[model samples]
Target: MTFLNHRHSSFLRSITQIVTGALLFVAVVSSAKAQDEKPEWKAGSAAVVITPEEPTWMAGYASRDKPAEGKFHDLYAKALVLEDLHGTRMAMITLDLIGVPRSVRENVEQRVEQEYHLAPASLLINASHTHSGPELRSRYLLVKRHDAKWAALADQYANDLEDKLVALIGTAIEKLAPANLFYSHARAGISMNRRLPTPGGVTNSPYPDGPVDQDVPVLIVESPDKELKTVVFGYACHNTVLGLYYYCGDYAGYAQEYLEAEHPGTIAMFMMGCGGDQNPYPRSTKEWAERHGRALANATEAAIIAHRTVVHGPLKSAYDYADLEFAPPASREQLEQDKESTNIYVKLHAETLLDELATSGSINTHYSYPVQVIKLGSEILMIALAGEVVVDYSLELKRRFGNTNVWVAGYSNDVFGYVPSLRVLREGGYEGGGAMLYTSLPGPFTETVEERIYEKIDELVQEVSTR
Candidate 1:
């Protein structure tokens, strides 16, 4: 009986040993699979100088400068491509220009989709809003300056930019490898509200005090070897550093230069946040531009020096487009008889809209707007909206969705014109009605613009979260 019991006990012990070995092997295999599944973040950056030899019109701040026959500060088209281990990718190309036209963006999108396999919505192209950069597609505003020569030159520059951007993205994709992403947000008070309100007047002063976005978010990219590869920063202010005709990238461009120089081989992408109503304070000089640049660079440096939360992302991206409609302007005779005829362009646009309305009886007041949201794991939510969005959208979204991580971006897909809030529409100002002259659109947006945008954003956020 004792021998039989010992044999049974030994058999049980042997079974236990075999089970333990199997568990260990499974653990090893699971760990190996996890390692294999770990996504690698690879990145690359390239810049193409776009400064013209001869002086031309600058973009923001409205002030003009004399022809620059000699060389001035150089403008650049900087491209940063980011890809995962599986080769799915996104490219952000920042241009040191006034504004990115819808046509130009579409052209670039087609090129990226054809060449880099990047989806049209995946490519984010933004302008620095530099007043010193050449005016590309503001013919509606600067009609007299839009000569055939200028148009040809602008087309050539845009075509060249597309090629350069494609090449840059391809190079970056080829240079992909493992990398780390860390994100941090800091506030800087370098910008002020450009549209200030006057006492007891519905009309805002040409120079009015308004709200501004002070938050500056920085995304630091590090190679797998732990070397700093890029520091992408965003702020909501127009880069109107120097309103001179000589080509310059303004403060945002200078900020990139400063950061890149400070950290060699490290690229910097400056994305303009919700700065439609914001303008850089103390602008209009190379020195002030450098100062602001250093301020932004310092903010980035501080974010890096301070403890930052490393973000591991299994990125999920979604893009949605909506049609936003605007009310047609009054009849041509009525518009001609209306009060605010100080700007000839506004009157002309009104006349044009009225002509269409008279012929068709009703204008097709709808515009195709794009909204894109990207979720980085369960943490970061990056929302991109088309047109020049005001600060209220960002502030409101941040307040309503404080529980979730949100980064709202404007000047994304199609930059038709200023996307004013309901409040702005009611107030009746440049952002609401006056700014419509800047586009081919009829007039002020419908009062439902705010609600339309909010609903679309909510839908996009939900889609991204669920997916």
Candidate 2:
């Protein structure tokens, strides 16, 4: 002002005022827009223990010589129900078991649709795949599923489980009330890639340098008063800590227990991630499992304390099936030859296939796999894929669905077997095609396994996110 002309000084002052006014206007508009987009949710949750009443055959270990001797803790099937403003409801059922058979899923969905009036697409059933949990009945594990007495007991257990799951869903929906949901995550390091490449090929051992997902994604559901009600968290690691005679939920079980203890009267739900190839290291004992569980629970606490994004949701969901092709079954000559092999599992597998061919005349060449996508508010995308999914799917989906929150979950709906990525299939390890020798599946999947799934996910995301 000391040297400037009078008109020039006045012009500069006017320009500064205009720019400041514009910035203030923009900030106010942004605040209003955020308020408009925020969403309110009605949430209800219930937890029920699903452990078998009697000592029964446990799942997940082929080397077990007898039935379960004792139990470290009871297993659970927890349900969370959320209703949007439009009265549309979505229910999530998480189980502490080896896997949910396709039949169980089908029957439960049918009953829920009839009883609760919930759409098939609105319900998601996920299993923890805990190796220590009791074995459910299956038509796939033809090699060594269970003997007559145990099989009968397992069938009865599954029947009772379906009833429990249905009732829990109803209970949660009945308890629905106003709530706020937020999303946050932290990291845990107990899980490592168990498939190691050695001179002998991909061996099931801890490879510290291999790809692993240490993410512990958490969703916090709170009542109107902001009191915590339910906590849903995920980790991409197998529940195989203790392979002892006692039934347990493994590390995932212990993690849930610790969380519930820390926050009394709150339900902690654990959803297994794409952990088909991941395993908790330093495992094989109850103490090791507890250590890993503490690590996971602490990770959840860390995520709960970290900065979180408020989840405003109109709650959109989409579920569909993708037809995945399989390589042709082994020739009849190969089956006959396999029956003479020394490996008992291999022989049993061959005999089962031969019997199937005699009865059905042809083997199934494709599987109709389920894939789901849910949009939370405007930013978060949840991709729930069926199977024991590998880690590549999760990593690749996050990359493809850029600028949005992505959570890819495996072991949902129907967990047929290891759903290998194209890379794993080509690498030709147990997950590739070798494990098929123990199931009714034909063989390794066709090369389109990963592409088909990704395409279906893209389609579902597009469908759900359009609103």
Candidate 3:
């Protein structure tokens, strides 16, 4: 009887020890899972319709003879503010317009700093390069038509837009909440290299063999409960699918619209990549635009579905200007001759330069081009380059940065004109120099343009990466 009782006690003690060990292991695992699931970032997003209430002059194509009469859909300006665990914040504002003027960026930067205490380095303004959006540059209209009414309308719209954008940023920041960030990418075949090489020169035609960046990079933001919040995706293609009189965001707008519809209560923002020389094929109709938009949206969705890298962050941002030199300005005699030409754009450009020479004493030999870099922990490196950047920059940067999670965006901050790579510049094409005939800038950039931009980008990247 004593031996039996001792055996029962030993059995009970062993069972107790086993149960306790199992519980301890379970507790340890649960704690680790909880820690892993904790949000590493805070994010907020807001979007506002920017479509003009009244008849507004359209941007992109200068050939349009009249103001916009109707609408395919309303345009938009969206803001997304992201904060790291340490409280470093970065605000990304995207416009469904032709470009982000330097003036607009400067104004927003100054006001956001003053009002919201958001540093200029923390602000990133990108444009969709939508050809159908309202003309934000009053001077372009003023110089082209010499109509004060048109210029005033555009100027008034721009001023109102500034206020709207600033308020939108504030709203986004106010709505910040705990969130998770992710990075993934998928490919879409909508963009084709428009810089076709021909015996004549580089014509703006589809070059199937030419390099293109069709990889659509996506940044997903979601709540801790796994509710999708914001989807920010990027594509390296011109948003010039439909150049109709009515306002539209083209394929970009359609993609955002589709994404938002598919994910109810979510905001989608499109960032233009280095697609200065890329264009969608079979374009010019609203249907085609919608098709391309759907394609891009599908690609984004696929990216989201794919395994995504967890974007851990103690976000760091840096911004600076690159002094991009213009090739020597056309001589006075050349300008004088150009002013007398039959081409209105050429004459206007020459007259604009001559006026600048008269007013400022000399033509501007260099432009203070804006360059920005944002590093998300050690996982992601985002480099935003101003102007209509060519595809080469995108490909080269990805190559140089190892292409894993590096995102290079163009048409950011100040999309003054085309930014051709050294290859494109040496090739001598529309993007190389001929496109300058349409702008008031003094023709092609100097050879050092690419080098100077790269130098600044490297400096900024190093500055942000270290912190």
TM-score of each: 0.84, 0.91, 0.94
lDDT of each: 0.73, 0.88, 0.93
**Any runs in candidate 3 off by more than 4 Å, and if so which?**
1-37
- Cα RMSD for predicted model 1: 7.4
* Cα lDDT of model 1 by residue, 99-193, tens digit: 77778778878887887788875687777677777656535434544446665666666677667777877877777667777778887777877
Pitting candidate 2 against candidate 3, the one with the higher lDDT is 3
Candidate 2 on 1-467: residue-level lDDT in tens? Answer: 58989998989999999998999999999988865643488999999998789888888887887888988998999999998778788999899999878888999999999998998888889899998888775443324655677877888888999999999999998989888898999999989998889987888888888788888989999886678899999999999988988988899999999999999989999999999889998989999999999999999999888998888867899999999999888899999999898998888888888888999998778899999888877757888989899998888888898687788789999987899999889877877778877667777899999999988988898899785
Any runs in candidate 1 off by more than 4 Å, and if so which? 1-39, 61-72, 138-142, 200-210, 335-343, 350-363
Which wins on TM-score, candidate 1 or candidate 3?
A: 3
Number of clashes recorded per candidate? 4, 0, 0
Assess candidate 2 and give its lDDT. 0.88
Angstrom error at residue 467, model 2: 5.1
lDDT for model 3: 0.93
- Candidate 3's residue-wise lDDT over 194-304, tens digit each? 988888888889899999999999999999888999999999999989999999999999999999999999999999999999999989999999999999999999999
Candidate 3 positional error at 125, Å: 0.3
